[model samples]
Target chain A: MRYSKYFLIIIILLSVFNLYAEKPFKYVETGVNTNSWALIPAGEFHFGQHQHIKNIDYDFEIMITDVTNEQYANYLNEALEKGTIYAKKDTIWGYHPGDPFDAYLHEWEIPAGDYPHMPINEPGLRLNYENGKFSPKAGYENHPMVEVSWFGAKAYADYYGYRLPTELEWEKAARGTGTNDYPWGNTVKRNQANFISSHNLFAKMFGDVVKTTPVGFYNGNNYDGYQTVEGISPYGLYDMAGNVYQWTGDDHPKVHYRYMRGGSYQSYEYNLRVWPRNSAGPEYTSMSLGFRCARDID
Target chain B: MVEWGVKDITVKLLGLDLESVERSGRIIMLYHVIAMIVTSIEVYMITSIVPMRKHQRTNINATITVGWITAMIFGMAFAYFGHNYFYHGLFLVGQSLIFFAGILLAVTLNPWNKHFLVENKEYAHTKNGYDLERIAFFVMTVSMLISAGFGAVTGSFWSNGHETFLAEDLIRQPDKTALQKSIIGYLHIMLTLIAIAITLIVGRWMDFKGKLHKFAMPIMIFGTLVISGGVWSVVWTHMAHTFIYIGSTFVMFAALLLVIYAWGKLIKDRIKEQGLKNPSFGQKFVALFHDPIKFGPFWQMVFMNFTVSGVGIFMAVKLEEIFRVWPAREERITLTGHWHIPAALIATIILMYYIDIAGIKGKLRKWLGWTIIIGSDIAFAAMTIMSMKRLFVTEYYQTPLVNWTMLATDFGLGIILILLAGVLGWRLIDLFRSDNRWSKESASPELELERTAVLTKQGRDVIKKEMEI
Candidate 1:
């Protein structure tokens, strides 16, 4: 009877090993393509499923894919050396100005000081810092950098003179002037994006790996026999509705919480809608939380 | 930019619709599955029942060739997923060796030349001295020859098209007329001829020696002649539909005659049984016609021939024309649902044959045939109807009420097919593991007849070499 616990542990260990052993499909993420940018020009579009029209007079550029592990690792190394960021015992910490609180009904003030950006000690963190340098785990270099809190994501964007897109900017970049529910048009077929239970090619080929796909994975191609649908947004942005929930720049007036958009891979598809806004504290982070950067045009 | 299945560039250069090739290319796999797995196994079993020689050498040669063909074709199925077609063209050469085993059967059994001796009695391959099957075999052979010749024409068209049009670097549509004609001829010959041959030959296996079979020969011969000669008649006369109908009608008429002859004999046998003496009204009604429950492969094949040719295609086509259903307008859903009738049920027949080879009797063998055969035919028929549902009906079918009904129907069918495969696998486990219960049976001439029917050439050789020592 005592051996049963050992047997269970052995079973779990085997399953976890099986999960990582299935190397990701090449299309899952072009880890290198994260540097590419898409320009969303000034326009008024249906802001949500309710057709609330909103306009922007200025243009802005945004990363086409999520911030990949390699991109963030490079940022971490630079920040560490430049003394812009520092590490605690098991987490990389960064400073943030506290969020405002109206103290309305349930609103509590988020007085930020030193906050943990990412917990580097966990198994799920794909970027590792060692030997006075930060490097992405081998073979996971192109996957979206997860375990990133709103603060960590903001710090990365600010380090590069970019900012997390406001909710308006993120929605415009994703939905465009098109009155469609998704980044593409009306329909969302399996494997078109990497949301939960998408049964994308990697999921179909190796059933064990339920982890994140590499950024920009759904560009249409038939590999061997598996097929994928083109998944770029209206303005050429990729993974606008999946991969990870992007931390947006908005700190709501009395909500005291940061805004997130484009639901993560762990989210049910309804949360991926352009108007279906998700929010969390500035310090909150999870395996499904990550962000991209945006900057205004001169 | 065409987004599904292989392009089949060779067929593409011919100016034919690539979608048709992609969709219909799968039908050949069905035909060959029937030819190799079910029909070949049936032929082997029939060799024991027929009035033929032990056919030691013929059987040996067949064991080697068939074993090789099965392996190659099985490899071809997987190779397709890997993008290797026709086993990189080697499968074409390898599969043609079936003709070699067939010719050996013809020569040794000598069913064509002399009567074979079975159990010290003259078991004539002929239907009580009728020559219809012989004529059917001849017709099938000539049609096959025409198919082969036109296959060459198809190849030549592709070769020439590759140089003249495909290689010229301009993307104008080449004339696909001649290539279409060749393909049409090849496919028509194969389908119509194989159907005609199977219809004629299934009767003789039951030893049905009736005068009705004598009349079926001429009608079928005329049908084969019209189809073989009219392969390209559509190009000149533009009456391909009329000619195909005339040919098909004759073929169906011949099959109807054979089916009547068989059922007539089966009813006669049941009526002659003494157990029905002074029977009730139900018994009298049953005596009037044979019970479907007691149906073996022969009876099932006869019923299959009638329903598929006589009723199935007729209704499917009528529904398509009159109702404007799906599969008629849809490119992917095949209108020829009759293929599914044979493709699905013939596998059940293979299970029955497996039971016979294993000599496992009682309830397992007794009820397995009728249960599977009845379930499969009905389920496939339901599937054929559902596939033809209109777009409106299909949309409505997504409703909870309709979806639940469909789920029940699907689960029922799923159980039948799963049961068939499960039973087959259960039997195969013994053979594959070689518990030696099947392998160590004593070698008598009777045992040789049974053993040779089941074992491979290597197994036969091992037993023969052991006996010699």
Candidate 2:
């Protein structure tokens, strides 16, 4: 009876040790299985300008890519059904209604009849629709969602039990412990981002092309047929330099504007620099705008 | 040396891309040749047609012709050298030479002196107005020379700052000092201001010439206000908002009123004096079949206005593209005015010809002139109102169109368009009412005799006899 008791105690100790041995940096997938997240280990990182460097600490899980159109559409539809959200048709700047030449107008709507749902295996869809429905263009299911306001992004994050990453957090994820000029490093090129250059080439290759590329279409190498793995950020975040500008948690309430980080397909090379600051009105929406979400680690 | 950004901005403002710079340079070289030919003709006509009372005429003519020829040769040589050297400074030197040649031609033409000597001998003894005008002209010439000299030496006219051709670089480096802050730059600015002041004085002197020169003061004032406003925006960036926005616009509106009144008076006077006698319906009809070169001034004005308006339209379109984030309505209306200016100018030319053939005179002439002027002004006013509404009433900060500099530029363009419409409207009225119709044969007998004398002196007996017949 004494030997059996000793064996039981050892087994209990082993069980407790196993519980403590669980990995700190766990990989978490969204409940809807729409996106993957990486758990960033707790650490302090230097942030801000050289003259006013800041050390910030955080342990959080961040989305691997910007929220995709299909994911947003799903969230939007569910919210509408629950009477938690509503879509309003408003005239966007630079877009004239009934003007055939005005290509900037975008209508936010939920997908309905005849509009094919994004495939589960695809990244996400573009927000192209007719008759007030979210009908993404064919083959654009994997593209990053854009034309979403900061409020909409916030709502999406809240619905998913996440929040927009702070500027420091986003920068830490992009540049890590180093002071790189870009997410990919000091140099920026066409393959390193889906910027104006890439869009130009895409337009040449395919007539009447959409500006944004599929999320994670560039896998740290071979972007638009060019072989290079210099685009990936330190934390394995795809499109840390370009694709669509990501909304950050930072805001200047006095100015009524919020900070946006990374860059978009419409961004110039200089704008894609990691340290360059950009902002817009919180209510503003543009074709080159989007967001990702983050959550605190327990 | 010009910074790349300044060069790019200049090119953009001129509605050209960097890729087209070399082509434009080539075209400018060609323009030098054409200018030389035209200058030569002008020199010949001025020396030959204007009867010189003294033996000094030969010396004056010889000096002018030689000076022009020398300037042209130097310009051509410098242009060729610049093309080979691929230096923008060298290209500027060539352009400056051509510009100097034009200045020399203007000096030789001496319109004020000619008008004083040939048209008004009665006031010669009093000579106060004549003396003042001469002094003003002298000051204007000297100031213009000083401005040009300073501009050339510092390369301020050619480049905005340190030579670079990329606009992106300049925008990225906003703290970099512009050449305009330097000594030579300041001198250029000062001289330009002096020239403008002298031009105003000259306009006042011209206005003293009774009701015939009524358009002088308003046109000059309008031009001065527009130029000063532009200078204020560019040089005194801090004051652009208030000074240019309100002051310049108010002055411009007043100038427009003056222009309309002056033109109305001139047209009324012409109508009271009766219509031109030459260029009978048959003559006008046959003149259309003649070589366009024979019509000279008419074709010249048409071509010049067309070229200028075409350039304006091009600039407006490019500016619209640059400010693509802004609402399109204001830009569209501005562009429409640019297009309409040339069309209206052309239509006025045709209408004047028809009025002459139809012998439309008296109350009809006055009414027609007023209708054209007032109609155009009303249209332009409507456009201005629309542009103003878009500029001031809308919430521009919500989009990417919140640039203060661009807003200022648009405002300036809108006011300038209004001023332009006013000027063109006056010119249209003047064209229809003027005694100097396209066919000089319709002129009064006394005027015809004076023209024949001038033609005979120029050794054009064939034309003089044609005039007598």
User: Considering every candidate listed, which one attains the maximal lDDT?
Assistant: 1
Docking band of candidate 1 = incorrect
- Model 2's CAPRI class is incorrect
What DockQ does each candidate score versus the true complex, computed on alpha carbons? Answer: 0.01, 0.03
What's model 2's overall lDDT? 0.47
Give the per-residue lDDT of model 2 (tens digit) for B1-469: 0122234456456543222223233444444344444434333333333332223344444554565555455545444334433344444444455455446534643534423332343211123323322332333344445544544554444434334222121221223353443322333234233323322322231223343233333443444444444443444364533443353344334333333333343444444454545535554444342322112214323342334334444545565332233322223444444434434333343343333334556665545444443444344334434433434433312122223433544554444355447645665675776564433432321111121012123335544666799
Worst window of 10 by summed lDDT in candidate 2 chain B: B445-454
- Using DockQ as the measure, which candidate wins? 2
Q: How close is candidate 2 to the true structure, as a TM-score?
A: 0.42
lDDT (10s digit) by residue, model 1, range B1-469:
1212234473456443322212223334434444544434434543443333455544734663565466456534523333344453554444445444544444444324323212211221234332344445555655655565575456455324422211111111123366565665565565565555455445554354445655676677788777666765654555766787788778767767766766666566776675555666666556644434334544556556554655546554665342221211121233344555555555554555455556666666556655666566556555544544433342212233333435654764676777767765775676677454445531321322311012335445666887899
